[model samples]
Target: MTESTTFNFIDSARRTVKLEQEAVGLLSTHLDDNFTRACQMIIQCRGRVVVTGMGKSGHVGNKMAATLASTGTPAFFVHPGEASHGDMGMITPGDVVIALSNSGETSEVTSLLPLLKRQGTQLISMTGNKESTLAKAADSHLYAGVDQEACPLDLAPTSSTTCALVMGDALAIALLEAKGFTAEDFAFSHPGGSLGRRLLLKVENIMHSGDQIPVVSPDTSLPEALLVATSKGLGLTTVADADGKLAGIFTDGDLRRAIDQGVDIRNASIKDVMTAGCKTTSPGMLAAEALKVMEDGKINALVVQDEGRTVGVINMHDMLRAGVI
Candidate 1:
């Protein structure tokens, strides 16, 4: 593409982002008692937050529901048209309803207003127009009004959707703080994510144990220890005493140092060449913590211990293969 054409596209993208950012920036001033009341309603909700909308608002509502659900607030989305077709059963009197409609007059959403009111479910409407029918019927309303759409035709839901999504996020975060939601709690909701893996995957879960662990007695010959390390493919072997208590560690680095010192690998005992005071980690500790210890010590492997006895071994390669990085 021509440089001028590329520059024009870049400039257009920047202008759109700037317009949406301005819409988001203006939302702070709109926060009032209604926002607080909405938070209170969600906080007190004994049931899930049922989000409902139509068209593009429905898409935004789905994302808002997911965000809320993942961040400690129990929530789910119900299409307004589906709600009219018996999906309203998903909502109960103890539930709080978050209705999104930019124009505040979407027929599909507004048509369910009377049924929702009859069920005594609290309604929190997010809309651009306070005077719209949906806003008028809500128990509380959050105005996500923007000056203009980012779309040149002023037709697509651009800045208005961004504002609505941000407002939803504000409500979810405010309720999360009010309820004292924590990272651990969030991890429970996202157990398959990287954060959950870092927080929950213990060293014991991934470390090589039993026959897979590379270990040699302190009196073992250097060549025998090398055999163990090679068989286990950990680039290192743990040296233990007669009682099976950890004594030290033998690594490729130690082997290289031994060779440089002209130590006879065929006749030397592992204790003579192994590095003393080896770094160790507990099995109960997180793999992330073990990874940190390896990084801080500038080492590639660690002995996994439990009750002062070496039970397993884990190397940097194991961690990488296990997605601990």
Candidate 2:
């Protein structure tokens, strides 16, 4: 009878999450002047931000570097063990070093402090041990201290690592905003990522322009319009006026509806069977936004217009191909 509730696995997970949450919540209080000082040092540096750490702290350092680099602050991770070898040559003057150490006593990380200091490089320390040697030696020290670990044994780097990661994010985002980092600037760094595509992929990049745009005159026969639509493979054709301005649009659905009402497809005028005032988009519109328009309007295609004249056509398949879907 007692074995049913002897060990509660769910309670264990809940306790770990609650402890870690409280740990992260406390980090905000310490985002004081020291944090700003760290950000300033990084911003003023002519060279890149070099992050270094050993063991679990090293894993956190790698992520910190990636976050910083992606958010407009140039940064990269350096393994402390390798710093003693030829890898240390990568560090040059004007570069700032952000060292991570839980105990502040990691020999591999501490060994390079004197060498980096000699180069007149600024050193920023992220450590749980603010009183440790590495902390006292740095120009700025960020306290990543936690009262207790989320780990049951208090041995693993649980709450401490989470604190480091969040601190890194706060630093990066603050710098990004300070530098007036726009979406276009972010796209430059992430040219192949989904965020880059959403911000930079324009309708014209994936649209059918020139001869690829299916067009039919207002007086063209419905059969001829159907041929233009099918031949272009867009399932629709724009009906233009004498001046090449868009008059209306004829889609496959219009053909089916006209046929159902016995409006002879072989002889009906295109203007009589077309839907006027079709929805249009500009070539400069983001393809992702165009996808939203297509979804909102319940239509699959949009005509690209500039000053009331047709420029091109963009459809759902184009969005899909451009990874905007």
Candidate 3:
């Protein structure tokens, strides 16, 4: 390590990223008829898309398969080495196989071609070498070639692997669009995540309904409404009419304003101090949407109404507890 050859880590990192970035950018030109054919074949597949590769290509294949599965396509990864030792049983004639080989000549990957051909399984190959054996043997070949490796020796699979991953992402997104996958569909696939909770959880699921709701009749005195608000712990209480319909709401803000205006809290009814026709929401609405409604109105809670009748009440803290915030 001479002073002249200080080995600038930042310089090396920037160069590697720049090379990989260009590799990903150039992959667009390779999205030709072959890419479309591969997508069509997978779309028509009655069974899962079984991805197989060896070494570094195998790592990329694993992620590609995961992406496909999460994006409305049924897919999984199988190691090509294991495929030769009976893992090929996992694949079926109705399935489509996606094989990856950077040099397009991995022996383990190529060895399964005969068995796949015997099963009459369609093949889609992703390779850096267009003229390689694996590319020629496939039903369709997706070009993931890179001009140069980020590695100074031009040996390591750097830019080439990046391009393969980007190309696989392109394929998954295209299939997702073609299948008309919605956010709710994605939430169903990932039910345990925050995104799923935000998209799938409705206001009714986490609202305080029936006896849990803090409410009082419009003629109830302000002091009594304060007691209901405190007992329910929602910082506010709804004011209902004789017909059991929402009339208005009395919140902590109303109490503060009444004090500032020197109003009589003991004798004045909630109807005199309640804020009428305040921001309201529906129980069928998404909890995330309800959170937005609260945010838009700068209010801490919302009354859930159905046909102008109060069904439930939700607050910002409830949305937070449900992970809708």
Name the best candidate (by TM-score).
3
Residue 166 C-alpha lDDT in model 3: 89
lDDT of 2 by residue, 1-325 (tens): 4876788989989999999999999999877788989989998999999999998899999999998898899999999889899888989878999999989989999999889988888999999987999999999999989999999899999999999888888888999999999887888899998888988999889999999999999999988888899999999999999988898998887888898989977779999999999999998888888889989999889999987889999998888788877
Off by over 4 Å in 1: 1-7, 180-184, 192-196, 261-264
For residue 105, model 1's alpha carbon misses the true position, in angstroms, by 2.0
- TM-score, ranked from best to worst: 3, 2, 1
TM-score pick, better of 1 and 2: 2
Error of 3 at 218 (Å): 2.0
Q: What does the lDDT read for residue 210 in candidate 3?
A: 90
| lDDT values, one for every candidate | 0.92, 0.91, 0.93
Clash count per candidate: 0, 0, 0
Candidate 2 TM-score versus the reference: 0.91
Instruction: lDDT for model 3, please.
Output: 0.93
RMSD of each: 2.8, 2.4, 1.8
Error of 3 at 88 (Å): 0.5
Candidate 3 minimal-lDDT segment of 10 residues: 1-10
Q: Arrange candidates by lDDT, highest first: which order?
A: 3, 1, 2
